[model samples]
Target: MDVRSDTALRLPASDVSPWVGLIGLATLLSYILFARSFPEISAALGFENDLGRLSGPYSALLAMVLTGGAMAAWSVCVEKVHRNPSTGIDWDRRRPVADVLNDSITKLAGLWATWFIIAGLYCLGRWYWDGAYLFAMQVMGAAVVPLVLLSVPYVIWIDRVMDDPRDQSWHFGAMLIGRENFDVELVKKHWRAWIIKGFFSAFMISILPSGFAAVVDSDVTEIVRDPVRLGVLLFELLFVIDVQIGTVGYLLTFRPLDAHIRSGNPFLAGWLAALVCYPPLAWGVLGNILQYEVNTADWAYWLADYPALLWLWAGWLVFLTAIYAWATVAFGIRFSNLTYRGVLTNGPYRFTRHPAYVAKNLFWWGSVLPFLVTNGSMVDMIRNTAFLALVSGIYYWRARTEEAHLLLEDEKYREYWDWMQENGAITSRIARLLDRMNPRKGMSGAVQPAE
Candidate 1:
């Protein structure tokens, strides 16, 4: 019998260096910690404490700049991502302004028109004017003038160095301008990318202030006495890290740092799976329609009588949350849903293809303990567990679609997938177990990046 070595498999070469994300993670943590303790620092320095704590939405917004700037600087100064062919930037092939003027104008026209359409959609979408989204709409509305004004010179300058000055946006511009030829496919691509940015960016920005405030204003004095308190605090902190870095990833699609969205996931199934997990759709499905918490009490309530078990369960939940956060950290500045900026094979990804999904599902299971219910109804127990399982299944579906998209789009992802199947410490074991159950089955199949 052949024996497999006990040692861990060699991690595949990561398309994204872990350093970029790690630097961002470190910078983000530094800013968050400083924000958390700003009041004390202000008084200690003999400065007026009029501003109180820097835990507001504006502060949270600034954190994105600090963390993203750190990652971008590292990608440029250290990794030299600008020179990578993937960036589509050719610094050596600069053309005179006159040559690219018309092309730049077309691109600018396309971009401005795209932004205007986004604004129109925002107006039509009732969700944008209500609740948390109000802040996001306001911020975006405030920036429309500046963005339109600034696009002129910015487009002309960048167009000069672009190897192919007529990109997807340019195609869209050409269609509108009516003088130049444009491809229908490229126009679709432009909308796909912009739609992703407009939709997800607003969602991300909307949720930022609430979580940041929770962390900043949290009174942790009782945390030591109660595992529930500690767990909630840690969970909020980890999520804040995820949202802050993730927002930056969505917003900073600049070509200079080579962090631009190369392609949005073209698969309709991919979009459906992702969209169902967020916003108006989720508010209906996951929030109410399929609400799994109907008669369920959390791990804390179940274990309130047993202090040891409560703490243990809380710690487990926190560990899972940490894993989820680490998965985002690994992506660094390239973290976004429904798009392939690059493949990541480092950090928690070295362990599994979808650490965030796994961790998130496991966290829900541990914290909710859907099996145990306060109502003690067999019906409730069965219903809650079943619904949670369906929720996990949704994530599994999302992961499969994402893998299919990536495998088709990039050869690098194929190598990563195969490597994980054979050598990933956790993934390999899981794959083998699944194979045993369904011997004829494979993990995931490749499909179109878009429809």
Candidate 2:
């Protein structure tokens, strides 16, 4: 099993099996038709409806339907592009919209079936452990376990079935040290001359006031009295500190001996849109364009009309920031954009493919509530919606470009990309949309291979 052998390196033959699409379609149809029976199904399983007004009987059903549709769309896209190894006419050929839509519907059925089994298992768990704490734990486990079971086996199957018989040694652990060639001269040169240095300088200057304000506004005595408050404060501090460390590390530390830099997206729209996200640049460009700053209002003010949800809003804020910092910690010193330090499959990375981007975007949407801030004017509503959409779209572009870069850098990344497509529990709507936009394209906005 010589992994480097040319004969073994090529992709395997396509599995254009009709049964796959048929099974998926059947599963999707079942869910959509039986959605009304979800409440009865839950009750029969001994699971109580505790979400109350926040989530009605139809809520779970609707969520499941939407999830099924998204999963189906993603599955079909991956199959159309990556699953078929035959790279000639079929590679460039575009299937008719009707055929694509049918395939997607079929995948939705497969996804729905998977969720159905998971829900049944969740019900079984509830029957066993009826306590609130245990029920909550079981609910979380149920959400994740099915996906892991389905996806992990798929990854292993792909590896075993691949023509190359991918070397186990090429996994994430091997990526940590890389090809050990520690060039001291190169490290010094990079530190002395890099655009990242200017970014670090600007970042520090920008974060200063917010960092200071976190400390200044907190009441030490009050924090000490309440454990929950103390925990929240500590999370905020850790978030701030981790972000700074990540910024510094991006420029000053964690040098890879053997590095591969991917070509940047040439599109002005992608880079320019992404640039306005950071400070100094944001202050210069976005500050002028935006009439009101999003962060000026509290989460509760924008989210819930009642003051009762303040604590809930605060909790969400803490959760969001913690996840962001968790991602930074996972990356260690390899957190730069448009570059591959190495493949990271541990920590938060293990949970989802792009936890940082997803979490950051989630936080922004939750905190900003752009549509909620109408301010008694149609124009304001439109403006806020447009602004947030632009910001979100930029991040989406960032994710796409980064994926393109990684896909070109190494075969290992291609393997990872495939695994994520099959098994990753979370899906990015933006990523899916981009793929839909050009299903036949290898990587949108052409990129140069790593030198």
Candidate 3:
């Protein structure tokens, strides 16, 4: 097959069917409904429950389980993802347990060592013990024993049927034990994937409880009358959806669902771009050094006098936030910052390559109104706008590094890249604008994204 042919290259069918995301979304919505009505139901049943709302952090954790389990079941039963070639499993070719027993033992050794290193890093990072991360640390501490005990059986069983059981974990083990020749690159890939999972998983889990609780306990009586209040409530709800769905993506990287991390971004630039946008580093750099919202009055402040404009602007911001959440939902159980589970060509992706980034940056600009300062200092206004532009530029750089990683990782991503250049609605227009500016980009033969 000529993969580069126009007929073959045009928008390939989505690797992840949209139905996977829908099932998860449906499960999440139902959970939210039940959480909101729990108090009323408890009272009707003459129960003595006194919490008044299902706002516990554990309830939020349960939301992740429900959403993740539903999506995994759908992937295994409906999509038959377990049968996919990428899983590296051949159910019909099971080997004698004794044949792969040594390999499984070595692999388990590497897996245990990797977990220990990750746990050490978690303890070393001070942020993990502070603020929202405390819950995450508690959860990890509780899972330590269970994860260790379950790894033995799971590793042994999977190794017996795997087409070739010497995977990345095996290579790492071989490197450590000096039992046989091990590829240097495979060991690096193994560590890279685990490091990404460790770092982002903590951040994602740390954020889940607060947003989940907010959505469940939101008081909408007063919000129903005020446009600003209603808008903020909606923002909280949408962000909870995004965080819940995205957290599931991080937690459920199981082979049966074909959602394992194929690779993590290898470039240092990718790491810097992503890390600086999150906590600790972001707290110092973007929040303090380049603080763009120093004297800014947000959308509510500016539009307070104009009631009609206030309502319209609030609605506009809500729309952008919805797009941000929708982008995460489109990933189904495959969403993560620096990994590729599959090529997504449906939903908001069919229009723009980076809908989440674009919407997120726009949301910041609209909500903060950074250019319109309260003190009316021209220097402050210019500084605010310029810093915000720099923030957006960072997202652009992140997008580039991601495209470069995926371009080299899979041909499907390359095909999607080419297809978007020709047929994507927003992507095609952006590509044209860039071409008009460079006029030499086509001759380069390098795949660059409009993101």
Weakest 10 consecutive residues of candidate 1 by summed lDDT:
1-10
Tens-digit lDDT track of model 1 for 1-451: 2223323234457768889888998998898889988989988898888777788888888888899999999999999998989889899999999999999988988998999898899999998999999989888888889888888888888889989999999999999989557999889888889999999999999988999888887888856677889889999999998998899889889887788888888999999999999998999989987788987878877788998988888888989999999898888888899998877988999889999999999998888889888877999899999999999999999999999999989877887887798878789898778766764443453221233
Colliding residue pairs in candidate 3: none
RMSD of 1: 4.1
In terms of lDDT, the best-performing candidate is 3
Q: Residue 47 of model 2: what lDDT?
A: 87
lDDT of 3: 0.88
The prediction achieving the highest TM-score against the true structure is: 3
State which candidate, 1 or 3, has the greater TM-score.
Answer: 3
Number of the candidate with higher lDDT, 1 or 2: 1
The candidate with the higher lDDT, 2 or 3, is 3
Model 3, residue 159: displacement in angstroms? 1.3
CA lDDT, candidate 2, residue 155: 35
Over all chains combined, what TM-score does candidate 1 have?
0.93
**Error in Å for residue 420 of model 3:** 0.6
lDDT of 3 by residue, 1-451 (tens): 1125775447877878888888988999899888889989898999987887778889889888899899899989989988999887888888888999999999998999999999999889998999999999999899989999998989988998788789889999988899787888989989988988888889888998988888888888867879898999899989988998898898888776789888888999999999899887999879987799988989999999999999999999999999999999999999999887889999999888899998999999999988899998999999999999999999999999999999999888888888898788899899878776874455455444466
